[model samples]
Target: MEQWLGSLIKSGKRVVAPVKHDDIVDFAVISSPAQVADDYVQTRLSAKQYVFPKAEVLFSYKKDGKDVTIDDVNTDEFPETVLWKLHPCDVAGLEPLGAIFNWDYKDSLYNARRAKTTLVTFACAASDEYCFCASVGGGPGNTDGSDVQVTMLPDGDALVELISDKGKALLTDDIKGETSSADGIDKEKFIAKVEKKFTVDEIIKKLEGSFSSPIWQEQSDRCLGCGACAYVCPTCACFDIQEDSHLHGGRRVRSWDSCGFSLFTLHTGGYNPRTTQSARWRQRVLHKFSYMPERLHVTGCTGCGRCSRACPVDMNLVEHLTEIASHE
Candidate 1:
């Protein structure tokens, strides 16, 4: 089946899958299924904006001083994109993005492109010290938001499970593989052995109780407020609105932003709502572990653990959550 799938994808049909680059794996246009990099434990880039880019132009505008004209950008230009070999958290992160992009204002630039893309995810058979998807309800080898889920058999063969029609289309007779029900697999056993060690409910509940906890200040003391954690996080969805202009015309653009920045909540009066790193860190934790749940039915974390890995001061989510969860 693997060989057949590779042949189908290689037929110049515009398929993209994860491929290894340097120390991390990233999704790219694959000429064949053999180019897919399921062996990589994690990806450097969160699978967030392959569908909704980090920055996009909503529309362009022109003004005759008294008259301002707004021209909505054409949505028909978005191309179909495919993503494969995603971890559990990266897959689930898309849902939270849907909440905000679809809130009061519908972002056509994002939703239009997202609609044209299909996501194919693979369960993580093994994870490093930084992974903790299991604690967030997505364990190693877990499939939450994927259209198709893949598993590597003990004999190094691959199993394909189509969770959605979009996923089934990725298959071809040339790939010659068997189908199985992934539903009954022993997910807990897989997580217990290799996935990160953490508890999702406990962290969420602890966050709910730690709104004013002094630990936020202490835990965030070493934070440089660089926003790297937010940038690398799979579920961080804050964005800033801006207008780009030339001499005669301009357009409104939205780019990914982070709450970790000192000026994220700044006002014109020079008052910053979250000036300190602790306050910013507190906001980050509360937003993902608490506030997001209130707004969306799902937790905002997919638990890829990149933030924990990327922190300059070594701010570990597992350590922070463990301490916070133990406060009770």
Candidate 2:
């Protein structure tokens, strides 16, 4: 693994992997295997930022008298990036996240970045209470959006599955061992057991008639409207475009936004559509379970449980969704 990573770095491909920083695990650029976190169950943040930046300049404009000059961002300069050691759930999230950007009008900027990024996912050998990937059409071994899937065996060797041409392209002669038949290897035995709490279909169906349910209020009463959930969520693609102006020039920037924010739905006329936390909370759940599934034919969540982990108020998504699914 170290040699392969070193080779990629030497080849000028930017490799971002999970790294442990002061006991917190998050994705960071690494040049060596020693910088990669080996004991982490999940990264504190997703690798989505490699493709979709938190804030990016779309274009710049300069004012000269009555004429304005516009310069658009060049997508050609985007680096070829490799996201390594990502979990299956995190990799699965790329599907819905990609769908959001490419569903209607194609986002050239997003597509360009996404095209240059390759995913290397590691199957989960252990899980915690917050993980619910199985309930959302994902599993510890799910490789929905993985270019390369690596499953570690009990004997310290790994079973590497090249799922795409890009994945196969990453292999070097040293890393490409002789292909062996896995006639009796049961991958399930090596992965974590994540119980299915509620299915996506059931959640979608229940959410269809749950718009005015009191559960939103019940669940959001303690919500601080911090937007931590959306920020940490791998599939949340909501963004706000703003223009930063100076004396002679300005740039259009797109920054991440969240439905959980209190002012997210505020109108220019001082009228807010979602005035309460319950409404904001309801939008967050329904948008993922009901709206995206109905519109894009994809579940917006991979059940990574990052939102729950990042929430200061301790809002457990699986618990809330399971409760909603049980609703009449």
Candidate 3:
């Protein structure tokens, strides 16, 4: 499918995938095969931007008189975009985000983009000290949110496993002939490795018990509250709604916000719910580990370790979970 993907992009079709730039791989629009790099450790940004862009103009507005006309963003002409070689962690993060977006009021912009894009996740073999996807129900070959999953086996043969209709449609009748057993994927070994490092059931219990612990404040003392961690996190989906104006009139804009920001929980009446980095950090953990799971029936963390990787202070999320989970 990689070669086929290259053909589509080269042929001027919209095939957005991961490409290396400035020594870091990021998902971008590609026009050739030479542009892609599958071995990139972790992208500086998450795959969420394809669906929810960093700085998207929700709509444009103009006012001629007391009667103002609002023009809704034209998403009716979106193109078919294919995301290739995404990690399981980045892919799985999209699940919980869907709930919040579709709740109360529907976000047509985000939903429209998602509907047009097909996710093709590439399995990862390399593990880092900060990575704990195994603990979060992810592995080297997890196929959760992936429509098409490409697994590179030790024998130098690639395994193309299709999970959804979009994945099924990508295969030509000729390449469809290569049907090998998935038994060699080693599901048991992948699962066992995660279980040895962490216990999901016990960790959930510990997370439930420590909501008001003083450790939260002590651990977060050095945090700068720059919002970098949450901004880079695929699972962090907090957003801000505002009005972008040009004197005559304005349009309402919704942009990505972070819980790490001091202004995040600030009320319009001038009361700040979470006033410090310690409080903000606590909210981040609770939202991912408790509140989201309670409402969404799934934890918000993918354990991709991007937060740890991108943190200016080098605050490790894996270490945080392990410390609390192992505490007596």
Candidate 4:
């Protein structure tokens, strides 16, 4: 692992990997392989930040007298990068994000970074109670958006599957792995061992008419409106564009926003469509389970379970979904 990471860095490409900061593990740019952590189940934040930044200056402007000069932030400056040690679920999470950004109108900033980034994902060997990857049509060995999928063998070696042209470009003669069909036999078995509590399809079917359900209000009553779910989510694409101005200069910035907050649906005329916590919660649930899947033909929830872990009130998504499913 060290040698492979070092090879990537020595090749003059920026390498981002899971780094340990105290008790938390998150992906960050690493100069050396030693900075990578080994004992992390899932990253605190997904790898989506590389493609879609949390906040960025879109353009800057200056005003003097009556003339205004505008300067756009360069979207083409992204360096060739390798995202290593990402879990399969996180890799699959990027699929929905890419779909939304490229659905009707293409986002040049997102496309530019995605074009330059190569994803190297590690298959999950185990899972926790909060994880429902299989339930959402994903597994430890599922390779949806990964450029290269890597499965750990019993002998401490890796079985590498090159998934795309970007994945193939990073391969070197020193990297030894089988890219043939024989490698999948064991991987399928490994994936078969993974168990999910319930199917996302079942939840989606239940969510079809749940907009007026009383369960949303009951479940969301304790929600602090912290927006942690959207912040950590890999597929949540809501953002707000704002312009910051001084006396003579300013910049237009794009930052992440969340439907969990009341201000998200606020109108300039002092009316908010989603006025109550129940309405906001319903939007969050429906957006992922109903709306996005209906539009993109892909499930918005990746079942990574970060939102459940990060929730201050212990608002478990699986539990709520299961309860909703049981309702008539």
lDDT agreement of model 3 with the native: 0.78
Alpha-carbon TM-score of each model against the true structure:
0.87, 0.97, 0.91, 0.94
Candidate 2 regions off by >4 Å? Answer: 177-183
Better of 1 and 3 by TM-score: 3
Candidate 4, residues 87-146, lDDT tens digits: the string is 888888788988999999998888888888899998887677778788788888888889
Clashing pairs in 3: none
* Rank by TM-score (best first): 2, 4, 3, 1
Residue 180's lDDT within candidate 2 is 70
Give every collision pair in model 2: none
Measured over all alpha carbons after superposition, the RMSD of each candidate to the real structure, in angstroms, is 3.0, 1.3, 2.6, 2.1
Quote model 3's TM-score: 0.91
Residue-level lDDT tens digits of model 1 in 1-328: 4565565465544566678877777767777666667556677778776765688888898888788888998887766666666666677788888886786788777688778777777667777888777677776666667887766667665666688887777676544345445665654443324544567677777777677789999898888888788877777878889989986789998888988888889998998877788888888888888887777666777778889888889999978877887887
User: lDDT scores for all predictions?
Assistant: 0.74, 0.89, 0.78, 0.85
